[model samples]
Target: MPIWVTEWALIDWFAGPDYPDSARQGEYAEASAAMMEELSIVERYAWFSLPYWDHIPSLGLYHPGPVATPAGEAYARAGG
Candidate 1:
């Protein structure tokens, strides 16, 4: 059974009220790099489930709801 981490949970954990919108603004470079290393380490031996493939927008991302977000921006850039 794959335990998928929900986008809502990630946003709540990383982009929470405690985290200033500006402060956590980045690709989270170090963390992303570590994840790559960890993924390579556990590619064969299972340790934990992978994260959700798609990302969801936070409350801030949508002003009134269902608006533009960086995720949406990236998606558009990708010709999504």
Candidate 2:
């Protein structure tokens, strides 16, 4: 028998100036939820690529310290 694993990212890098809004609007979350719902039928799992992706200058990866973003809230509500 064999097992399969996968990972995915939800950021819209090509959104350019609207990247922030794109990330916060739950669009990615909705997509993730839909994918997960489909995967659920197959008993598969999905991993979020990054929880906190912001990189600060000279400070390295930025950790918001357990804060929840609007997208995160929507994701949870979507059963993600």
Candidate 3:
């Protein structure tokens, strides 16, 4: 089964500093996609921008939810 990892801290870390908003977001998506492809375990993966306090901004990862499929089962087994 494939494993899905969501690290909000990592997103915050990467989104910090001199990087342009578009570039940072683009890199985040590209990296996540590449990771999924490399693992060959994920059926789907997604990321979204969210508003943070003081306009800091944040990102979120949403899988197919808690009852989707093999991915859901794996997620549950992994204590998602």
Model 3 residue 25 CA deviation in Å: 1.4
lDDT of candidate 2 over 2-79, digit per residue (tens): 333455434455765233353444566567666666663434544443355564111111226755555565556766
lDDT for model 3, please: 0.39
Q: Which ten residues in a row have the lowest lDDT in candidate 2?
A: 54-63
lDDT of each: 0.31, 0.48, 0.39
lDDT of 2: 0.48
Residue 63's lDDT within candidate 1 is 28
Better of 2 and 3 by TM-score: 2
TM per candidate comes to: 0.29, 0.46, 0.37
Runs in model 2 deviating more than 4 A are 1-5, 11-25, 39-41, 56-63
| Pairs with backbone N, CA or C atoms under 3 Å apart (clashes), candidate 1 | none
Model 1's alpha-carbon lDDT is: 0.31
Candidate numbers, best TM-score first, in rank order = 2, 3, 1
